[model samples]
Every structure is written in structure tokens, then in C-alpha cells.
Target: MAPESTNPRGDLTSEVLHALSKSDPISSTEAFPGVPFESIKAALDRLASRSMVTYEQVEREEALLEPEAEIIVSHGSHEARVFEAVRQAIDGLSIQDLENKIGDKTVTKVGQGKAFKEKWIKKDGAKLVALVDSINDVTRDQLKVIQETRTHDAKILADLKKRKLLKMQKVISFRISKGPKFALEMVKEETDLTAEMLASGAWKTATFKPYNFKALGADQHAGALHPLNKVRQEFRQIFFEMGFEEMPTNQFVESGFWNFDALFVPQQHPARDLQDTFYVSDPVKAGRPAPASADDKHDYEAYFQNVREVHENGKYGSIGYRYPWSEDESLRLVLRTHTTSVSAAMLQKLAGQRKDGRVPPARYFSIDRVFRNETLDATHLCEFHQVEGVIADYGLTLGGLMEFMEIFFGAMGVTDLRFKPAYNPYTEPSMEIFSHHKGLNKLIEIGNSGIFRPEMLEVCLSDYQISSMKIETGGRR
Candidate 1:
């Protein structure tokens, strides 16, 4: 009885280490015959990662016999078999008899033609007789040599491959050698030190894996500001370059008294409706405007009364909306619908007398978030930023305002501006600013600008001061 053969792969890694211990370098194919290439490669890789073994892949083409070539190796070549069967016959074998004897018509037919071409056989009145008494059977001999050696000359290999008797396959083997940390026994590597190792004093003798500092660490995916904020910063820089002070718009929540009434927006305006504005619910009522700090000496009561009177009745040489204005509506807390609200508060602060007994001309700008109760769309949002600017001085006119708008927009590479006459409740002769868009082949409205109406500025500035102010709003679009 034959003994059961053991699987070489069962202890491939240990076998490799043991082999490397005896030899400086060993061929995996010669050391581990009948083992799978993948299994040997996996074992070598495992040892290499631990720095216990190193190896180089050795690749070559090995000739493998096909079924026909294997059969020829076991038996003789097809043509040789045909010649032997014919020579063994007492009289000679007929074609049909030869086919029956060989049990393969294809081999018999092909061999018969080859034998006739080689003059090894001749036709004797429909009987096949051998013309030669002895035959070499070179094909069978060559295939046998290839079966033992797995290769021959390149020309012979090509011929054999063309004959479909053999095929060439890429065989990968490894040349393994002892690495720097070569060992017959694998030791457990410590990736990190623990308290237990320190307590036992085992760290001194423990083998720790070396760190690969060259390896790239995992991505952190750091944070960044939104595109709107980046653009806001750029606009702020431009405002600063133009001598405009940045208003503190951190107060997103504001009373209607500052957001609307001070801006000359009537209480009955469509913009004040629940569908158009976001009204805060908790602590719905807000206190009336008062001094921001002890140093603030602005008359908030007088400014508050002036706003109420302007909206309720005529004020500053113009008839007001003449509708019943509610103090509750004025003091209703809401998410500010515009940064213009901040502009309004700043303007009111300028109303107080300075050391010169007059309000100084000022340039102010704000870029911050605003909330609106509106249907969301690609071009519209419930909350977005507004870029607004205000300039107050004497002798400022519409022409100067247009020129300033050109220079402001030009600084940001916008040109060919066209202003269309429009109207706003707070700004007389309002203009909707548009710039020619070459891509759209038309003008697109980029912002709105106008001078503050006398009715609106009267409550915020002294009567003796005829101030002209231009508001550039919605430029963020």
C-alpha cells in the first residue's frame, strides 16, 4: 500500500524559515515541489513583512504537454503506431482494418497521409504495407524529451506549440534569502508598549516593529469657510479700501422699529406680510429702542416718535402712507430681513451731535446674513447674505452716485453698467443696476441703488443738515 502524502502548504512558512536557516539562498520551486505558487508567495510575503526573509520573483515559461502529447508519451506517436500495427500484421492492414485496430479514425487518417508523404508506407492493391522495416519515431522521442525536461530549443518549442501538442505557461518562483532579522522561530512583534509590558519589565527584551515615517497619514478632511463667506471677505476688503467702515451686523435679531419703520417702510407694505418676512415667535414683543450704552446720548425717544409720525401722518414736506401704524408691529421681534436694518441703526446713531456740533460725513458697509419667508428655488433662498453700503455727505448727486457705482463695480471687473429708473419706498428715483453679461447676451440686474428720501433721512438727521446718501444693496447677487 502507498503511504498518504502530506500537504506541503500546511507548514509552508515554517518550512521556508527552516530551509533559509540551512541555506543562504534557496529556489522555492526546488525546495517546495508540488506546492502551489500562490501558497509559496504568500509564505514569503508573510516573512518579508516581519523582516525575517527577503525574496525576488523568478519568472520563466514552462512547456506543458497537451492531452495528445501526453498520450504520445504514454504510447508511441500516431504515425509510429500506424506503422507498427501494419508491420505486425501477417499480410498488411486495409484502411478500414487500420481504423478498427487503432479505434481512432482521425489519427489513423492523419498518420496515413504523413506516413505516405514520408514514404514509410505504400498502397498494395488497397492494403497499406510498410515501405521501411525500421522507423525512428522522432516525434514521439521529441515529445518524451520535452515531457522530462519541460523545454527545448526555441524553434522546437514553437513548432510543438504550432502542432497543438504542447503549450507554454508562465511559472513564477521565488529566490529566498535570510533577511536582517532572520530567525528560525517567528517572534510576536509589539506594535506599541502597554502597561503590562512595563510592569513585567518585558519591554527591554521585546521586539517592536519599526515605524515607517515615510508613509503618508490618513486624510484629515479639514474645515473651510463657505463660498459666500469668502466672497464676503473679499467685498469687505474692497469696502475698507474705499474708506467704508464695517457695521457690526452680529445682531441678526431686530425690532421692526429699526428694520422697517426707520427705513420708511410702511406698516401696510407687502414686505411686512407673514409670507414675505420671518416673524420670531418666542418673546414676540420687543422693547422700544434705547441708548445702546451709557456713553450713548442719542435721543431714542425722539427718533422713535419721528418714525411713528412719519408713517402715520405727513412729515418732512410729504404725506405719509396715512394708515394706522401699530406700536406692537413696530416692536415685533423678527429675524432681520436685510442688512439694511443695520444701516438704518448706524444712520440713527449718527444723528447725535458731535464735538463739531454736526454729524460727520460717513461711509459704511455691511455683508451679513438675512432671513426671508419665501419659496425656495435655484435662484432664491429662505436665508442668504446681503451686501449693502451707505455713503453720507453734502452735495452728493445722482450723477456722482452713478459714477461711484461704476468705479465700485469696476474694481471687481464689472463694466458696461446700465441703470434703469425704479422706485423704492425709502429711496427716491431708485435705479436697478444692471451689467451686460456676454455669456447671456443680455443685461442682468446685479444690484439696486438710490438716494435716501428726505422723508426717511429727516428722522435720522438734523433739519439743518441736508444730507444726501446713496444705498447700494443686493450687490452680493
Candidate 2:
């Protein structure tokens, strides 16, 4: 016999070893009677950690009463109710009358069928007559017994299950046994080699805990860039390789003037609808762009007049949208819907340079986040990144745009390129770009490209040629 100990760990370890010495195996319930199984499991785990015992879990089926079955056990089965109803009647009631007395349709239907099958009742015309003097409900009695005992008789349990009166659940139980280092008693194991023990010459007799070299250690996580950032980096590198200057797109907040009006997009365009664009409203207003000096104010007024005329009266051998352009609407602030806003600003700066007689050929590119008010799905998001490129020189054409795209995508191992006819408000002769997807075995539309329309270009420059294209990407699909 093992000595009883007050320490729960030592006591549990000793009990398990003692039980295993007598019986080859013992269940957790059998070893720790009247104790919570979880507490016992915890004690067993501590012992197993010390390599003094071990356990194997087995799944067993347990029977439990369904809600309806419990009601039957409490109030008596439907057949029992029918039998009692018949006994209470001096002259047997008719089938319809008995149904009225019972009220429950299931009880009426099943009870009558079962009573007739057992010859406990017989039909006399429309009336039901009791043929037996007394009856017993074996189903109800068995269910009550099962509920009280929490044990099952195979045949009875199967019958109740077929009737949907009992449900079976899979429960886990532990079968524990002695480990390789089984012992009748447990001693506290030291986890460290203390200086006090060494100084007292007690290190030689200390029972140190064993080390488990095979045990897994905590995961070591290091910082890494997000998938979108990695792709953006690759795009940045490609832009650098192509001698394209990076445009500053740090301004996520922009006025509708630069976002749409300067781009020659109509005020009433569907893209400006609340359903498609996210409008900012905390301050509820954005300050107007102030001029640097009186001369700057005069220059901006002239530019503003030209943009307003282009939207209302058309310009440069083209018909404008011929609608009222609202200065208030243009002043409204929003989260930028595209990176092209930055390109628009850069174009304005280029226009000022042209005024100063210093127009220079330039290529600009930007990759930045944008927002929209749209329904989200696996293939769409409310916010995403936009990649844009602009070229300003003496003579850029639609053909030049196509060639530029070919070279740009070719650097990334994408050789197969297709351009489909498309439409945009600010870009004429627009085309949607596609690339062959090997894994998908089809051509997938990748982005959009086109030469900027004259109406959009006239607002930015007067004596220099310019072409711009934008692509929306970095959204989950």
C-alpha cells in the first residue's frame, strides 16, 4: 500500500501507480471516484509530464433523452394517455370524440394505431370500444428506468433510438496505466541546480527533473512585409528600371476639384455618386487651395476659368459635356478614388513650368492606396491600390502607350498581352489590358490603358504632349 499524502500531485501519482500495480488498466472515473474528471485529468497530465504514468483516450457512445422523450417520461407516453382516456369513459367514445378529449394530434394518431394493434381497443362503427380492462405502457416505463439509472439495455436502447426518443453522443474517456518509470511513491523533482545546494554538498543527492529534448519549443516569429507591400516594391523597382520618376502620393485626402474636375470628369458622372465614392464629413468642409501671392492668385483664376469652360463649353476642337459645373461640388473633400489625382497635380506643376519656358520631357509613376464606397466581396474591396504612369514630351501617341505597356509587363515574365476596346470618360480610344494566365488557362483582364483626351490635357499643359494610363490592383480576389 502507498502512504497517503496531502499534496494533490503526490497523492494522485501514488494512487495511479498503486491502481496500475493491481489492475492492468483503470479508467479516470474508476480511479478518482466523486472527483471532477477534468481535475483528475490535470493531475494525470502532471504525472505523465514527469514520466511516472501515461494515458490513452478512447471515445465511447453515451445515450441521452431528447426533449420529447423526457416529456413522455414525465407525463406518460401517448399510448398510455389513450388507454387511460378509454378507462375513464363508461361507454367508449367515438374516434373523433377521443381525439377531441386528447387534444394532441400525435397522441391521437399514434395512440389509436398502437392501441388497436395491441387489441386493447376495437372499432365499433364510428366509436372506439375498449377490449381490455387494463393496460401497461412498456415504452414509457423503460424510458423512465433508463433516465433514473443512466445505463442502457442494448435492445431497449435501440428501440428507443429508432423512435427518435433518445440521442447518442460521443464522449471521451481516459484509460491510464503505469509508465516506464513507475513507482509506489513520488518525490519533488528540482528544476534548477541552485548555488545553495552546491554549497551544502547536496547536489549529488538532489532528484533533478528529466529533460525532454524532443518536446517542441515556442514558435519564433520575425517581422515581414505584407504581401501587398512586396508587390508594390517590385512595381517600384520596375518603375526605377524604366527611368520613371516617382510621384508623391502621400495625400490620401483630396478635393473633388483635383480628383475629378481637373481630370475632365463631369460633375454628374455615375462615378461621383455616393454609392461609388467615399465622402469625408467630420470637418464637413475642406479649405480652398490658397495662392502663394497676388500673381499666383491671378494665374490660378485663369486656370480655373479654363477648366470651367472645358466642362461647360468644350475646348480644343472637342464638344464639352455642356452642363452646369458646380464650384461647391468641386470643393467637396473625399478620400481619393484613384492615384491619378497625384498625376493631375503633377501635370498642373508641369503647366506652371511651361509658363516659365522650362518645359522638360518627363516620365512619372505612382503606386498608392485609394478608397471607394462599394459592396465588398472576395473579388472586390472598399479600398485598394492604384498604379499609374504619365509621359510628357513633344509627341506621345496611342501606339507609344501600347509599346510602353508591352515593355513594362515583359520585364515581369508576362509576354502575352492583349488590349480590348474599352471606354472611359477622360480617355478616348481606351482599351482594357489582358494577360494569359497559365494556371487559369485563360486570358484575364489585368488593367486599363489609354491616351489622355485633349480636354484633360488642355487643363494641364498648353505646349507639351502628354499621355497617361492608370491600373487598379492590389485587391483580394
Candidate 3:
């Protein structure tokens, strides 16, 4: 092995631009010897894009997940957290470093299983002495449950059974049946049927074709969707079955007017930042266009009125949001950070016609990709889909929200859940929903829900009445 270079360097592009200005089309070997040619080509293309060079970049390889990397970072694992923390702490430790530290070992063989077990016990005697006390009743009980759940290897099962906490009870039973009758045999020379002479006739030699009978393949597993995704599909189907029209799919690139400003999010809040959301290449945010002058005779004046009412306060005699409403800053564009964005859009679609008599009990659902600059981890992705739904009409309340959440989770095969107070700009008295997972022994925050605030209502509904009314303000209770 040779020692690698550790010299300080100038920008590759700056170097390339300087050389290209003076040299004829130089080959990658001339440009970056000892460096990968593909990297050299990329620098040239970037330079060319800015009119600094005349070369194109060819991609050498596509990025792929390493098998070992995938194993240590898959979701639903607390183990990954520890693994990552330990790996980060071990600075300057390489695979070769570990190998050198472990040194060489003598491989031994034993024919008998018991001999191998004895050897293992003897080798790890000190560790076993320290570990024996921690393997208490609860530990054994949990291990038994896990073994039963996994149905692992037979030897492992036997070891588990030997632990004394493991138990398998046998129940024996049998049923009697009618015994066989006369003996039967195959004979090549068949003769005289239904007569005593044919009962015991001489048989001729018989030969059969050679058959190479071998064991084939094993059983196949049925394909299935993930449980979370199945729940999302169910919600989607729920809305599709209802007559309420689905909202437009333009939210992934919606303006602040529809996402935050129209929905009454305080501009000073910390959520609207690159750290929390993805900003688009362009910043031309749009807002709910101001309604025509109060003196104008436009028929669409009623639409803006509904939006204003939703933001200013709750409709239908509900206590309106008391915050000073501003439409000027409501037009910034970014990723649809949450499915709550869909609810606002849905309300806009039903902006008018409350006078026509269609109001409360309006139902809508959306299961689509939403983006947020989340911390990527085993169970979390940079962006993921959410199942968003809302049922609106007069007399909708927080109890209804809780009831729907329970029913929805139950239908999705999640029987255990706990709720905590959460705040969302769109939903007043919002809640963060937590579900208990058996393995982890603690509640995991799964989703969020809340009753839309009056301002939210005004923004979404046409027949909204902006007045004080009874409502349980959302909070951690």
C-alpha cells in the first residue's frame, strides 16, 4: 500500500477554468491524474454550464445502498440509535483497526453438541457469572414470548425450554375408524371377472418407467402492504365513497395564503423556515386575493368573505380567532408540510353555497405525499405521506374528533392509543395522537388531529357564522 496525498488544494473548477483558458481540450488524465476521471468530467460540465468550459460530464455510477449500511439503519429499531451513537464515538476506528485489535484466534472443533456447549460456557464463565442475575423472571418471560412469536430454530427453542421458564403442554387424543378389508395386489395378466377362477390367478412380470422423484420448492409467502399504508388506503377509500369532492393536488407547491396566511398561522412562528420545510426555487408566494372593494357589485365578494371570517374567528357563532389578520404576508410558497394543508384547500373548494343549504357534515379525505425537512432516521424519512380527513357541518365538536380517531385506529388494527395536547395553526384544540406498541413498551406518537378553528372555518366554509360560541380550545389535557 502507498501513502495517499494530503496536500492543500485550490477549487477544481477554478483550476480547470484557469487551464481551459490557456490549453486546448485537455484529457481528464492531464487534468486530474491520481483522481477519478468521472469527478474530473463533472467539474468540466459545471464549468461549461456557466460558459467557462466546453465539456460534458458523464455519470460513472449510480448511488446504491450498501448491504451493511442498510442492516444497521432500518426502521422500527432502537438498536440503530445505539449503533449510530457508538459508531460516531469510535473516531479513527476502521475495519482494519478492529481486525488488528482482535488479533488472531485458534479455531477449535468439537463433535458433540454438549461438548461445544460446555466449551462455550467455560470460555464465557466470567461474563455468564455477571449476566445470570439480570436474566430474571421477567426477562425469561419476555424471551419466551418473543421466541413463540418468532418460532425460531429448533436448537434455540430447546435452549429456551431448558431455561425453566419456557413451557409447552401436550394434549393427546385419538379417533377410531373402520379397519381395512381384503388385501389387494397388481397383476399384469388379468383374467375372468366376477368368478372364483379369477380370484387367485398367476401374475406375469411387470416393469415400469424410471422416475427421478425429488423434492421441489417450498411454500411461498403472500404479498401484503405495510400496516400504516393500509390504514392510509382505508381513509382514502372512505372519502372516495363519500360524495364530498376531493381537493386539488396543487398543494405540494402552494402559496402561504392557502397553507399558512389564509389558515391563520402567526408569521413570527418558527415553523416557516428552511430548517422545517422545503422552499421552492422561486419565492413568488400567492395569497387569497383581497376581495373586491366593499362597494363593488361582484358576486364573488361572498367567497373572500368566507375566507376572512375563517381567519378572523370561528363561524356559526363561534369565538373568532382574535389575532390581527394580515393577507399581505400570506403568499409564500413551500412544500405542503402537512396533510392539514388539504383541509384548508378543501374548505376553499366549498367556499360558496352555504345559502344553497349544503354546510355541515361535509366530508373529505386526502392521502398524498407531504414534504417536511424532517430528521432522517430508522423510522423517519425526510418526507412521508399522511392520511388527512375532515368531517364538517354544524355542531361538529372535539368529542366527535376523538371518536373518529378511535374508530379509525381500531379499524387499522391499532387497539391501544394515548392522546396528548398539541398545537396546530389550522386546528384549534389540536391533539398529538400516541399509540402503544407491544414491543417497545411505551406510547409512540403516531399522528395529530383537532377541530378546525373559527378562523380556519371562515377560510374554508361559505356559510360560516363568525360569532362567539361554545368550543373546547385545544391543548394538552
On lDDT, the candidate that comes out on top is 1
Q: Is candidate 1 or candidate 3 better by lDDT?
A: 1
Off by over 4 Å in 1: 1-209, 212-224, 463-466, 473-476
lDDT of 2 by residue, 1-477 (tens): 122334435365566677788886776434555445566677788888877788988777767899888988988888877877887887878777888899988888998888888888887777777888888888888888878765589988999999999988766668887888777777878899999999998889989988879878888785687887887888889889988999999989988888898889999999999999988887545655557476652366666777899999999777898998888898788999988878877876777665446466778888888999979987778888887777777667778778888888887677699999898877787889899999999998877877777788767776534445444334221
lDDT of 3 by residue, 1-477 (tens): 112235534566556555544554553323444434445555555444334445432222112223322322332122222222223432323333323433321101111122223232122322111111111222224344444453444565566456442444332111111112111121222322434444554222322222325535577675687776675566666557544455556557876665665566756667777788777766666545544377543344465555556556645555655566665555667787766666765555555434456653566666677777888888667667666666766666677677767766676577677779887776678888888889899887777777766665654554554211111211111
Estimate every model's Cα lDDT from 0 to 1: 0.85, 0.78, 0.50
- TM-scores of all models? 0.56, 0.54, 0.44
lDDT-wise, the better of 2 and 3 is: 2
Q: Candidate 2's error at 152, in angstroms?
A: 87
Question: Relative to the unseen true structure, what is the C-alpha lDDT of residue 50 in candidate 3, on a scale of 0 to 100?
Answer: 35
Instruction: Give RMSD to native, each candidate.
Output: 15.3, 18.2, 31.7
Tens digits of per-residue lDDT for model 1, 88-198:
886888999999999999889888887888788888998999888989998888898899988988998899899899999876777898999898888878999999999
Worst 10 residues of 2 by lDDT: 1-10
Residue 168 of model 1 has an lDDT of 92
lDDT of 1: 0.85
RMSD of 2: 18.2
